[model samples]
Target: EAGVAQSPRYKIIEKRQSVAFWCNPISGHATLYWYQQILGQGPKLLIQFQNNGVVDDSQLPKDRFSAERLKGVDSTLKIQPAKLEDSAVYLCASSPRDSANYGYTFGSGTRLTVV
Candidate 1:
């Protein structure tokens, strides 16, 4: 089975610009997640989706960030009108539903650098 895949793996954008990140989870996985990891900090859960329906998105910054899992397979994360502090790594993860310790697999991530 193919592991999670993300594009660019690195991004540099000016503040106030818009940027998006992509993710492809492992095949047959039923749960997908998007996380934002700041430097020196553990990953924070931005959103969790069970298939295409949202399970939780409480931590997501709805103002400048948005995400989607249209087909419940591949996913995307976007940051609009980026900020200098928005520079961070965006990781995509997924796991099987049957296990509580689903053992999420993460993409290398899109490292956004805003200046």
Candidate 2:
């Protein structure tokens, strides 16, 4: 079973630039979720997709953040007009929980730093 995959491992951008991150969830997993974690706080769910259909995205910051899970597999999360407060770790995780339960298969995240 391969673990989740995230890209760049790190990123730095100006306060209003746009950036995107990619993810590949584990094999055979039907549920995928993207989360933003601040320096000290716990991981916060941004969006969740199940087989290309969204299950939950209430916490997603639509003003600047958007994501997609086309083909019901891989995914990408984007942030446009990034802000200084957007610096955080973007994590991608998957579980057998379908859409009701959640767990952490924590991967090396894309650490975005806004300047």
Writing each residue's lDDT as its tens digit, candidate 2 over 1-115 gives 7789889799999998999999998877888899999999999999998878999999999999999998988999999989999999999988766745465576789999999
Best by lDDT: 2
Q: For candidate 2, what's the RMSD?
A: 1.4
**Candidate 1 residue-wise lDDT, 1-115, digit = tens:** 7889999789999999999888889898999988889999999999998999898999988999898899888888889989998888888989988365758888788889999
Single out the weakest 10-residue window by summed lDDT for candidate 1.
98-107
Question: What does each candidate score in C-alpha RMSD?
Answer: 1.1, 1.4
Candidate 1: the clashing residue pairs are none
Error of 1 at 93 (Å): 0.4
**Regions of model 1 farther than 4 Å from truth:** none
What's each prediction's TM-score? 0.95, 0.93
Candidate 1: residue 98 Cα off by (Å): 6.0
Residue 115 miss distance in model 2 (angstroms):
0.4
- Residue 21, candidate 1: how far off, in angstroms? 0.5
